[model samples]
Target: MRVLVTGGAGFIGANFVHQTVRERPDVHVTVLDALTYAGDEASLSDVASAITFVRGDITDSPLVDRLVGEADVVIHFAAESHNDNSLSDPWPFVHTNVVGTFTLLEAVRRHGVRYHHISTDEVYGDLELDDPAKFTDQTPYNPSSPYSSTKASSDLLVRAWVRSFGVQGTISNCSNNYGPYQHVEKFIPRQITNLIDGVRPKLYGTGQNVRDWIHVEDHNTAVWAIVERGQIGRTYLIGADGEVDNKSVVETLLELMGQPADAYDLVSDRPGHDMRYAIDASTLRSELGWTPQYGSFRDGLAATIDWYRANEGWWRPRKDATEAKYATMGR
Candidate 1:
């Protein structure tokens, strides 16, 4: 099948691009990205020759329509992701996450194409530390942050289109993802990069916030499963059953790097920080018979750390770009 992967140049998206091409040689994939600071083309450089890369924003209805019309399936992954960045300003999140999803939904509806949405579990808000609150397909959304609120809105739009217009589609909300090719602004990679630079690893809040972590590769696999085998007009929760407190994650990194636990710095948490997040992925497993291949968080963390250690050049430039932006504002 010919598929269009929106925002496929970004971290998880780029990994999806590579994995898709490798797994299904017969499927042709097209990636549409705005090439934002977060959407670096270099991440997909290795597979650049194989996949169709279109540097465009998802809000462009005409572009999205054209691409959707030519493909059998569209995987919508484009969005302004990052809670810290979202809180500083929310307009971009609305423009990309909300309006962009609307644009893609309209395009896919007109084209009569099947679509899949890649969403985050943050939409369910925080679970009480002592009480379990794993978000399932039936969970009601209670997004607290700008990033999640906008994502929740986007998800609503997708559901509306499916029910009202009979658009063939499925949505998969996944837990926190960590792996190689990720931008350094994210929690795991940022902490890893800082540790490697001999700087204190910054932990948001008490670092007690809990999140169900899944490797990006496994998340991509789940997405493909939804696209290929999932039921139409349904939402699936994709998780690795790997849950950990933020402090524990940092401590694990320290142990892996042979650093002292005191090497961490407890910083002010981002506004509206969720206390915990987990996902009930039984729907995907029972329906699609999909299981996570990466079950051990320790193994995943070790492999991811090694990847960053071995590929400094990739992340160094990204960090430099963010630092440059800060410099520009200061000047």
Candidate 2:
């Protein structure tokens, strides 16, 4: 099988590539990435010789057309994905998430290639902290941030393409992913790296905002299961049933790192911050026979801490700049 992965050098996409190369020797993988601020070529360093890398933007019609034309499947993961960054400048989010998705849809429609879109659970907006309900396939779209709005638009585009143009495609909205190669700008990595550097972890708001966490490998495993076994034109929610509040997550990190549970600072909260997000991935689980391997969030988190500790070389260069950006925002 030939697979063309957009944003393959980024954290989650890079992990997908590493896992694919290790498990699926018959598959030839090609990565198309813009090498933006969040995209790192070094993330794919270990499997450098195993896959082909193309440096290009997903919005380039000709490049996207050529790449999609040659592939049996195209997994779209390229986008401006940070909520903080999107809130600062929404143009990149609109251009990359909405326009780039349109570009890919057109290419896939023209070539009749199988396409899978990667999305986030944030598109359904936040659930009240006490709500037992979780986001399901039938959940209505209710995006909060510029980042998620664009993602929601992209998801709609994929659905329209499938119905109107008969494009072979599937979509998956995954929960918060934490694993190796994640950028330090994200929540889990920021706190983990801060503790490693003897800096206090910063908590936003009251630190009660809840997120459904999932290991990147588990999420990607579900992605592959959908590609291989799922019906076309369906959307799958990928999660591991790992739900943790911000404060508790920080406390766990502190405990694992041998710091006081309360060794953290409260900072300004982000604008329009959602209270919580949860996912009901029953469709992917029961229908596709997929289940998470990471049964314990703490165990997965501890492994992630170890990865960042051992890979300081990969994350150090970006640490100061990320923290500086956050500092200037008073977050």
lDDT of each: 0.89, 0.96
For model 1, the local distance difference test gives: 0.89
- The TM-scores of all predictions, comma-separated, are 0.96, 0.99
lDDT of 1 by residue, 1-331 (tens): 8999999989899999999888889989899999997898898898888889899989998888899999999999888998878977899999999999999999999989999999999998889988866788888899998999999999999999999999999999999999988889888998898889887787877899999999999999999889889889899999999989999999999989999876797767667888889889998998899998876999999999999999998999877665465345431
Regions of model 1 farther than 4 Å from truth: 321-331
lDDT per residue for candidate 2 within 141-198, as digits (tens), equals 9999999999999999999999999999999999999999999999999999999999
lDDT of 1 at 29: 87
298 Cα displacement, candidate 1 (Å): 0.6
Model 2 — which ten-residue stretch has the worst lDDT?
322-331
Clashes of each: 0, 0
Candidate 2's C-alpha runs over 4 A off are none
Measured by lDDT, the strongest candidate is: 2
> Which ten-residue region of model 1 has the weakest summed lDDT?
322-331
